[model samples]
Target: MKILVVGGGTAGTIVANNLARRLTAETRSGKVQLTMLSASDRHMYQPGLLYVAFGQMTPDQLYRDQASLLEPTIDFHVDPVKKFMLDKKQVMTEAGKIHNYDILVIATGSRIVPDETPGLTEGAEFFYTEESAVKLYKRLREFQGGRVAVAIGVPHKCPVAPVELMFSLHDYFKARGIRDKVNLKYYYPIGRIHTIEAVAKWAKPEFDSLGIEYETLFNIKEVDAKNKIVKSEEGIDVEYDLLIVVPQHRGMEVIERDNLGEGGWIPTDRHSLAMKGHDNVYVVGDTTNLPVSKTGSAAHFQAEVLAENIASIIKIGAPVRDYDGKIYCFIEAGRDRATYSMFDYETPPDLKPPSKPMHWFKLSYNQMYWTSVRGLL
Candidate 1:
């Protein structure tokens, strides 16, 4: 059996590593072959980008050589797939090489498209990438007492990030002793402060306490950079001295180009994580159109379940597990305090109060992320 895993991000890496370990015997006997294809040779801890924006972590600390994180039994390649010939059970790479597989795992992650919104790329400061994070950090430092508007775009990676960014911004300005001078206003495309009801309920009071004003149902339409104004689709215009935006996201271009899914999100089974109508083809992470946050935690959980079922099918002639839509995320609530949310399909997350200990745990998890991706946690 040949297992071809694509994308090399958190989801792809974990599933590939887990399969490599679980199928070690079969692989050694040449009965099963595991391979991974990724665009980059380096694997990035994406959650750390938030810290990078806040100056808590540098970009260099967030990466590891992709090969260093993989198990020796698995064959890994940096060539990105350009074509998905699912009917032929093969993929053509950018380098014009063809790879055949009995099973395919598509974990190609999402990307931020600020340019989708008119004038947003030029007018807003977002920290989705390394360079953007550094640039935002510098912008935040040079900022001195003005209207700091934080706007959110839909279908973003982390669902809780808008609230988290608000909390962090409040703390950042407060720490700089300019909290009184900075007018922090938050805008959301939805009807609430956050998409998660529990989080919205919790964060609203917190925002009020911190004097963070908010306006919901403010979908982004365009930015008038010259006038320092942001116009919403609802006919409301907000003038800002500085704008920090959480841009919308879409899946990789390869997925879109192949017409595998709308906006590159593959239609996947909620439980089995397999692409709809294609049992042998699986999807995970941001590539799946799952009703879950596009966080590393979701990818990690999905990978575990998907890997287990695949390994079980290989070993026992039947699959053993189902993904329950389980997702866990740590919410950094600022001021050296943090909390977490854990939920699945059948249940909503119950948020706890932020605490210093929880904050410390989140900090430690930044380093532990590498271990977690290695299938150790």
Candidate 2:
């Protein structure tokens, strides 16, 4: 039997390593095999992109080679998956590598589609991907004091990132001695600034303290890039000297192209992480249409449940585990302070105090993630 996992990010890497360990005996006896696919050997620590964009960290600091994180038993293909042949139970890659699997895990994550919004690419700078983060870093480096507008073009991955960027931008301007000259504003598409009530409750005062105005119920209809203005569908317009944004996030192109998505997200059983029509296929991370924060912690929690179920199905007959959509998000308040929140499926995150100690924890965790992925942390 063979298991094919179609991602190599936080969720895919963690699940593959866990499954490899659980199926070691089978692998050793030639009874089972595990493999993964991605466009490259590199796995970007996505959250770190925020720091990289601010020049607080180097571009190379945000990535790790997947080979270092996965077990030696796993065969990793640094190739892009072109299409999924559901009837054939095979995945075709652009490089002509055909893969067949008895059990499939579609952890392809999310893709940021800026083209989904008109004039957004022309006016706004987004930092979700490594390439975009690097570009933003260059832009931020040369930017002088001006009105900066940050908004979400659509539902984005890493729900905490835009807020983090706002806080970090506050720090960035202050540190550059232009805090008095620069004006920063954030417009959210949803009614609330965050999905988690506790997070939104605590963030309000903090954002106000930094002089960053937060607006809700702002739906972006278009960006007049040439005029340096963002127009909302509700007849509101924001003028800016520079614009930063989180672009619309969608399921992998292959998934959408194959009609495997529900409104740009792959629908799955939140509890079991399984696709409805395919008993042997599971979805995780930003790909799932779960009403939870699409952070790495959420991915980690999903991976644990999915990997256990995969192991059980291989040994017994069916999955017995479930995911509760748990997540822990550490919000960077500024250069020296941070706050965190934790919650699961039916509960709202309880607010936690912002502290410098928590900032160190977040910084320390970034360096320790490699060890954690290897099951050491």
The RMSD of every model to the true structure, in order and in angstroms, is: 0.7, 1.5
Those runs of model 2 whose alpha carbons end farther than 4 Å from true positions after fitting are: none
Off by over 4 Å in 1: none
* Backbone clashes in model 1: 0
In terms of lDDT, the poorest run of 10 residues in model 1 is 154-163
Tens digits of per-residue lDDT for model 2, 1-377:
98999988888888899999989999888899999997778877778888889888887897788788889999888987898887888999999889999989988888888888889989889888788888999888888888889988667787888778898998888898988988888998878887667777788888887788888988888899999999998789999998898888777878888888965578889899988788888898888888876778888889988988899988997887889868888888888898888888777678778899999999999988887666444
**What does candidate 1's lDDT look like per residue over 126-184, in tens digits?**
99999999999999998999999999887899887888888999999999999999999
Best by lDDT: 1
Winning model by TM-score: 1
TM-score of 1: 0.99
Q: Score residue 207 of candidate 2 by CA lDDT.
A: 82
